[model samples]
Target: MSLKELLKKKETAIVAQWFDRVVNTYQLDTSRFLKSQKDAFANPVGNTLLQGLKAVFDETTDRMDNETVISFLDPIIRIRALQDFSASKAVGFVFFLKEIIREQTAKETQGNAALQAEMLLFESKIDELALTAFDIYMQCREKVYEIKANEVRNRTFTAFHRAGLVADWEEEPRH
Candidate 1:
């Protein structure tokens, strides 16, 4: 069977393994909560992550469009970006899929050279997906920084205004 067919057959197991790998990135208690909580409201991060992984896997196995993949990646990466993770850790979840796919398909592709080649191509697509995820991560970080900077600016302006050291432009005489 082709690599795509093999991947399709093993999709559930691969995605579950991929989700576990991602949850493992968190602290022990948080990881356990994320893994055990199935409710979307109570475990939004876990829900978004599992859904994103499944969608990304489907895209990788099929069309692999950059935009569609980014849409799936945004929520997961955004949550990580807002957390204390470094850029690598934030985007590293994408790489988990690669190892999961290899482990899931190893026995089937072991002696099949063509399936192995197809696996290589599929893994290359995953690399591209990771690149896209990194871009999304950076964008989310930039937005977070922008928000922080704006908050500081606003607070500074408020303080200055309260001290009568700064005035609104509208308070100035007409030029």
Candidate 2:
């Protein structure tokens, strides 16, 4: 079978493996909660990760578009970006798909030159996904920083204004 066909056949197993890998990145308490919860509200992060991987796996390997890939990944990335994870830990789940794919296709494509080449091509798609993920992760981090700065500004504004430390106040027009 062609590499794509093999991947399509094993999509469910691949997604399950990938999801497990992503959840394992969390602390044990979080991982336990994620594993046991199924509702999207109860486990939004886990649900998003699972749904995103499934969408990715459903794409034709060669035809996966950047926008669709990013859309699928953004939710999971945003959640991780707001958390305490380093950049690698936040986006490294993309690479986990490679291991899942490799394990799933190993026996079928072993020593087969043409199939092996196709598998490499598929792996390249994963690499592209990882790059896209990094971009999304950075953007999410920037938003998080912006939010934190705004919160600090809001809390400090009243104190600074009352003490006349912050001038240039643009008072609202009276109704």
Candidate 3:
């Protein structure tokens, strides 16, 4: 498939918006990221994942450099620990990345079959299919589940709620 065909309106804009947010979000706690301490470690794993994903899924290039996008993506990728398929977080990353990319692609591509095929092709870029982007997302999600479960077990959340650590939406969202 041609590059232009692969990068449709939905996918392109969504990818662009996400890239922008990743780089521009100032309040983003670097601590939330895994490889936040690594320097421009030459294609730092996250950058490679994001850039490679862009090249494979997107065709346009406006303000975001491939490297910059990669830098933003690196932490996300690390959080998923895609490189370590055995890691618990890999599933969450895959689901998150895939949903984000797929949503963007759907918005831009209008759910085109051609675009879907192109996206399927991009999956090959990931080192392990089992460790795909969606998988990483699932892993993260599972981790969150585990944490919440622990909190419930220890009644930490109850204590926190009693201590007024809950949000003001009225109550904490159910897991």
Candidate 4:
């Protein structure tokens, strides 16, 4: 694969793809959504949606266009889409946030430093955030999968406190 392809294989691209999913939640396809850009800023509700669209669009990549903002003094909100991520960190963490993206977008986004520095900083932060989120997922899964400790000890040579059945002394009482 080319460098672009490789970068796309990284999490930054995957993260951008997630934006694509979020954008469509409004029933607007990418091309159609962007096509409505100008009119989007023309009305009150249309303008609010437009602002959200621009923020998410800018978040998906490191670039922005003046046309993105309909007019003066638009708010610069941090979308937190990409965290400060290293290439290696991305390789390690991308899948943790998989629930955030749709499958098809999983292709195409590999990104590069070509994006603005601020964008790069946001993407890079994925390293830490991914790890933290994954850890939470693992802990929840562990508790969910935890087996009730077999209380075989109650009927064994040594008496143990537990409900139903006796367990070997070697078995721990806690999950």
RMSD of every prediction: 2.5, 4.3, 15.8, 16.0
lDDT score, candidate 1:
0.90
Q: Tell me model 3's lDDT, rounded to 2 decimals.
A: 0.48
Tens digit of lDDT per residue, candidate 2, span 35-88? 889999988887888888788767636478777877888888988887878899
Local error of candidate 4 at residue 63 (angstroms): 21
Query: CA lDDT of each candidate?
Result: 0.90, 0.84, 0.48, 0.38
Q: How many pairs of residues in model 2 come into backbone collision?
A: 0
Which candidate model has the greater lDDT, 1 or 4? Answer: 1
Q: Model 2: clashing residue pairs?
A: none
Q: Supply candidate 3's per-residue lDDT for 10.
A: 53
Q: Pick the candidate with the highest lDDT.
A: 1
Give candidate 4 misplaced runs (Cα > 4 Å): 1-115, 150-175
Is candidate 1 or 4 superior in TM-score? 1
Question: Which has the better TM-score: candidate 1, or candidate 2?
Answer: 1
Among these predictions, the greatest TM-score belongs to 1
Weakest lDDT window of 10 consecutive positions for candidate 1: 166-175
| Candidate 4 lDDT, 25-124, residue by residue in tens | 3335543554355664443333443455445334333332333422211221111112233323322333333344324333433343333343345444
TM-score of each: 0.88, 0.84, 0.31, 0.26
Q: Put the candidates in TM-score order, highest first.
A: 1, 2, 3, 4
